[model samples]
Target: MKTLYDVQQLLKKFNIYVYVGKRIWDIEVMALELDHLHQAQLITQDEFIQAKLVLTQQHRIEEQKNNGRDL
Candidate 1:
């Protein structure tokens, strides 16, 4: 997916929707869903890798923002 919203839309197509206040948690959930999709052959390895990279970058940014607030 090109964006988090795109990932969310993919999950929606599978009837999966989840949120728990934490942004990282949401990203982690998306990663898990992406893994499942990959294992099921619903998505390509390249898509999985790209989507994980996006989520990883976003997780890092969110973590940095949280750390900044703690300063």
Candidate 2:
């Protein structure tokens, strides 16, 4: 699971800059935008698959952490 610190490190590692959003990170919204581009043939399938994989993993981990059993 990604802690806030890990997320920060990931941003630095990827040289990513995210703008905050109303209910989600701007980066996430941008991802959907990218997906739309991919659907429109702007980005290659390989790039879209890679991004989808990474985002899926992150989301899965976050979901698991959020469902933790009470101690």
lDDT of each: 0.84, 0.54
Per-prediction TM-score: 0.84, 0.53
- Candidate 2: the clashing residue pairs are none
Local lDDT at 15 for model 1: 88
Decoy 1 TM-score against native: 0.84
Indicate which candidate wins on lDDT.
1
- Superposed Cα deviation of residue 46, candidate 2 (Å): 0.4
Candidate 1 C-alpha error for residue 24, in Å: 1.3
lDDT value for candidate 1?
Answer: 0.84
Q: What digit string (tens of lDDT, one per residue) describes model 2 on residues 1-71? A: 23433433444444555567422344465466556667778656776666666665666665666568443
